[model samples]
Target: MLLKYKYKLKPHKSQSVIISNWLEIARKQYNYRLAERLNWFEATRTPVNACPLNVSVVPVEGIYQNIPEFR
Candidate 1:
């Protein structure tokens, strides 16, 4: 099944830049982690299906936790 959702974002120019940078960082990190895991799996002759680095983030908390609480 396909899931769909929508929301509004009101980020300013600087905030948008920061968000873009963060997305790039996250992508690079995930790719590097996946590559390292794949190498290890190959060395041990393990199955490729064992990789979970590209899996879902069901237990993910808020990404902006450091932001101060709004009054």
Candidate 2:
């Protein structure tokens, strides 16, 4: 047998707004990186319709054609 618990939060308006902004920033960041990686793959004929769940999503060739050393 197993048990699980769920919790709900009722943050204040200001806090909720802050949280929403942070989430939006994170989502945008993720999409930006995803696009960068997908576009970098030139050799693969397979299309990237969505983010791959496979561990081998990035080939041995690697993603990011011009990843900045500082970034």
Candidate 3:
């Protein structure tokens, strides 16, 4: 079992402003990471009903080729 605790914070005006700025930076970083992860997921996924199996049949020099750097 695990126990969690929460505490309220009371800060001076300057401290409050600094904390707010830090929170904003964190929020932006979180949003950027989320979008990057979503884009990577979408790019790597193939449609289930794609015709002619379009994702396959790549040339030897194509991006999908078995390159060591890609891994």
Candidate 4:
């Protein structure tokens, strides 16, 4: 016979706050990467190759400064 178990997490106040912050950061990164892929596709009309993500033609001065450098 086989048995399965499931558990639910109940975080405290501080832990919940930390989790929220981490989730927010992850959401921002996801959006930024998605935009990068779309922009690349629009400009080249081709799929991305083995090129590094840091080789973006877009500027990072104003709006994208918060994104961590992958290089």
Candidate 5:
């Protein structure tokens, strides 16, 4: 058997302000990372379901391959 306890936080005015600022910073970072991922996918033309580091098939010289089909 196990028990879990949960509590809500009630911060002071200054603490709330600090928390709000941190939340804003976190949101900005999240958006930046999402945009970076989108840009990488667009540039590489890779599917979101495929792993970026998997390069099983080596391309021949002077030959360009499209994004490999992934299951």
Candidate 6:
């Protein structure tokens, strides 16, 4: 069997940490926004994602099953 791939990534320690932090922040922000949309819907009877500011989608099932933090 042969696997063929050609790619190079040379990230320094600081770069890696920055990327990790960004991902974590993004995930948390996404969840928080989703919660906000749900709250709006409950209070105002408007569906989440109905408005431009509330661009929320419930996480599709089984996506990102193995997040790094879980390890």
Clashes of each: 0, 0, 0, 0, 0, 0
Error of 5 at 47 (Å): 8.4
lDDT of each: 0.80, 0.78, 0.81, 0.83, 0.81, 0.78
- What's the best-to-worst order under TM-score? 5, 4, 2, 3, 1, 6
Error of 2 at 35 (Å): 0.6
lDDT of 1 by residue, 1-71 (tens): 99999999999999999999999999999999999988876666636687656544343556556678789
lDDT of 5: 0.81
Candidate 3 ranges beyond 4 A from true positions: 1-6, 48-71
User: In lDDT terms, which candidate is top?
Assistant: 4
What C-alpha lDDT does candidate 4 achieve relative to the native structure? 0.83
Sequence-dependent TM-score of model 3? 0.57
Candidate closest to the true structure, highest TM-score: 5
Model 1 clash tally, residue pairs: 0
Using TM-score as the yardstick, the better of models 2 and 5 is: 5
Q: Ten residues in a row with the worst lDDT in model 5?
A: 55-64
Return the TM-score for candidate 6, rounded to 2 decimals.
0.47
Model 2 C-alpha RMSD to native = 10.3
Q: What is candidate 6's lDDT per residue for 1-71, written digit by digit as tens?
A: 99999998788999999989999999999999999988976766555666654444545554666655543
| Candidate 3 C-alpha lDDT tens digits along 1-71 | 99999999999999999999999999999999999989877876866676544454456588746667643
For model 2, residues 1-71, the per-residue Cα lDDT tens digits are 89999999999999999999999999999999998877766534355686544547557656766676763
Q: What TM-score do all the candidates reach, one by one?
A: 0.53, 0.57, 0.57, 0.58, 0.63, 0.47
Model 4 deviation from the true structure expressed as Cα RMSD, one decimal place? 10.3
